[model samples]
Target: MENALSTVSSTLLSFFNSQALIAAYDVEIFEAIGDGATSQEVFEHCNLPESTGHQLLVAMVAMGFVEYRGDIYTLKPDMAPCLLKNGTQYMGTLARHASKFLYPLWANSAQAIRTNSNQRKETFGDERKWFDILYSEPNDVADFHAFLSVLADPFVESFLKGFNFSPYKAFLDLGSGRAALPRAILAANPHLNVAVCDLPEAVDHMRQELMSSGHSDQVDVYIGDVISGDLPEITQDLVHMGWMLHDYSIKTQKCILANVFKALPSGATFIASETPLLDDETGPTFVALLSINMLISSDGGIESTTAQYLDRLCEAGFTNVRAVTLDGPRTLLIGEKP
Candidate 1:
């Protein structure tokens, strides 16, 4: 039994943590406090008023994101690498994306649930498809994809290390944001050919990025849309869609699976990586919350249970459909076209 007031206070005060972190990233305060700087030095570096700057730093300190001693403030040991703008593990892009996009959309979560539809119109006054509004501006596109790529880094490592890509000669990754997975696949299996399929809005930029990264000759790029049944010719024996299936409703997911099944050659392998609900429908808390976030922000997007995902794959005419576990956050739903 927890104290009711304590529980209520915890929920009520959660916004303070979010706002403090948002403010810290917005002003690039972590970048300003280089190698343990005093309050005055940080203020001067960030061009912030001393009084307001002091307040924000104190808030961050309370949030355990920074440490203050001897009148100097510094990022906590664990936070330094993950918070600073130029830090090796910087995740400010995710923080920025949350503040700029998700926060506003989540504000109407109740309304979204009541209506069972996205609140994009209410949040941004743009009723276009989620991706359309997301990619409407160049900066927004970069913000969305950049943060997702960063978030996918650990998953990419887990996937590359865990999955056996040796059996396939040609591989294609759908919705291959940043081409991280494809890059690693090519590196791990040099004999295999790798390509990426993405919407036209994303293909050119991803192609340029791959070229700049010196993978111009090794990786191919194709334009495709899985939802509308518009897909590139299938030459890949192993096709992967990473962390993408949960972004749509069950019907659309089935459509996507069917489209992939139709596009692949007989006996080709199809894999989709997703963070699914447990069989008991308990909580992997972040993924559960993300389902609600999807409900509020996307068009009929919601997370599914592993059983639910496997069922959809089977319904799509995939033979030998099954869920494979990796030592990572995402579970792989695999099937074969027979």
Candidate 2:
């Protein structure tokens, strides 16, 4: 049994090593070439000794990360995705977001367990300014949108099947970054007339995406925070919010939901999807790590559970609440106001 446990531990270590390798690759060290670089050039770029770089490059090549052709060290096919910024779905922003804010705070998982504070302020400051930039700034938010377009695509496909968006004639995607979910929703149910609500910059970006996908005729963008004003020129039968509720405290979450609830028509569905952490999980895991990501990573943050969301929906005058699981790391909390 002890040998089996050790083997499991070693396997987990290899996974962590792979994560490290990926993070390093995201920083572009692998493809940092001046018309492509030699091992000595790589050493200079990485600020490491020539011999050490050679050893590392040889191992990476053996591990299928690089191609060794004559003297020039070239990146392998998969390595270029992370190495080239904005190339081949390179999600460098999420990496920067994770490393800059979430990594160190996750170290306190044990302490967070001991004190049950959600470790919001005890570790990373949940109300910090950096998160504000992440959430509200155009470029940072675009990075986040790009990050999600890749990371959440598979999850959306799986989870969206759990709830039926077909009943609603129109949808208002509040805080819709890249229109990824709405795009999927349209693909699934072609009848939906969608309006995306976000800042002006985001709306502008959304327009370009809608045009590219030939979905411009099906959807429209509305500029302005949903909380501050009326939703859009059009009234929506379904108010869809994907992965936005987990970025606020209970009070702010309620406020946002109330805003959404008010904009939606009677019998309309308010769809909110998040990675719900069961209320009494033992300690740090993916959901807990995500809770940390909500902090210093963004302002007005949290990772609320199903129970909490249910209460908020009820308080905001939503009826017939339902929790639907979206595969792996996310779930949909849909509230219908009738």
- Please provide, for model 1 over 250-314, each residue's C-alpha lDDT reduced to its tens digit, 9 standing for 90 to 100: 78888899899999999899999998998887988888999998899887889989999999999
Compared with the true structure, all predictions reach lDDT values of 0.87, 0.70
In terms of lDDT, the best-performing candidate is 1
The reply for model 2, stretches above 4 Å from the true place, is 1-23, 30-89, 99-132, 135-138, 211-214
- Residue 18's lDDT in candidate 1: 85
How do the residues 26-129 of candidate 2 rate in per-residue lDDT, one tens digit apiece?
A: 53556565246887778778777666567667766776767888888887766677556756667666666556445666666576556543444665555444
RMSD of each: 1.4, 5.0
Q: Stretches of candidate 1 above 4 Å error?
A: none
Q: What is the lDDT of residue 186 in candidate 2?
A: 79
Model 2 weakest lDDT span, ten residues long: 125-134
